[model samples]
Target: MNLKEQLMQDMKEAMKAKQSDRLGTIRQLRSAIKNKEIEARQELDDNGILGVISTAVKQRREAAQMYSDNGRPELAAKEDAELAVLQQYLPAQLSEAEVRDIVAAVIAETGATSMKDMGKVMPQVMAKTKGSADGKIVNQLVRELLAG
Candidate 1:
């Protein structure tokens, strides 16, 4: 089933089961997807839904860090829970070695010789690695490859 349909089904299940937390998280995701659709004036496909999920996960990560710094473990835990829920929709993440290999291939394809070519290399690398690899690790790999 598509993301929106799956979400609606899950929402119904959550309601029946009285899962307030899960229901709230799913509702928030739905709201995010709807807002994006309204803004763009187009319905979101699976890729767009994935983008929305990634953004929600990122926001929760940031909020979790802030909550932890403030000694609010309860709030931090909630954010972690939301992040976990969002991650359920994401594809399996790439391993570090896999990401490195992909970056190397992109660099070679782009004929990127030095750090100066990072801009040229990065777009291709990121397009290949998006949602699969961590951005920081990809950037570090690109930097190493360029420097070497």
Candidate 2:
């Protein structure tokens, strides 16, 4: 099943199982996806849906960090829980080695000889990683590889 269909199935299961927290998170995700579709005036394919989920995950991580820094562990824990739920829809994350290899390959393909070519390299790396790798990790790897 596609992501939207999978999410709807999970939502129904959450409701049937009386999983209030999971249900709420799934509903919020569905709402966000709907909003994105409306705003774009088009139905999102899997890649588009993944982009939305990625954005939500990033927001949750930032919110959780802010809550922790503000001494609000309860709120931070809630954000973490939601983040976990959202992450279930994402592809398996890339290992550090995998990300490094991909970044190196991208640099080679783009002929990026120095840090100056970061702009040219990053997009190709991101495309190859396909949301499996974190942007910060990929950027750091690219910089390290290119700097030397």
Name the TM-score of candidate 1.
0.91
Those runs of model 1 whose alpha carbons end farther than 4 Å from true positions after fitting are: none
The window of 10 residues in a row where model 1 has the poorest summed lDDT is 128-137
Q: State residue 125's C-alpha deviation in candidate 2, in Å.
A: 0.8
Give the Cα error of residue 136 in candidate 1, in Å. 3.1
The lDDT per prediction is 0.89, 0.92
Candidate 1: the clashing residue pairs are none
lDDT of 2 at 103: 88
Candidate closest to the true structure, highest TM-score: 2
lDDT of 2: 0.92
After superposing candidate 2, which stretches have Cα over 4 Å from the reference? Answer: none
Which pairs of residues collide in candidate 2? Answer: none
Per-prediction count of colliding residue pairs?
0, 0
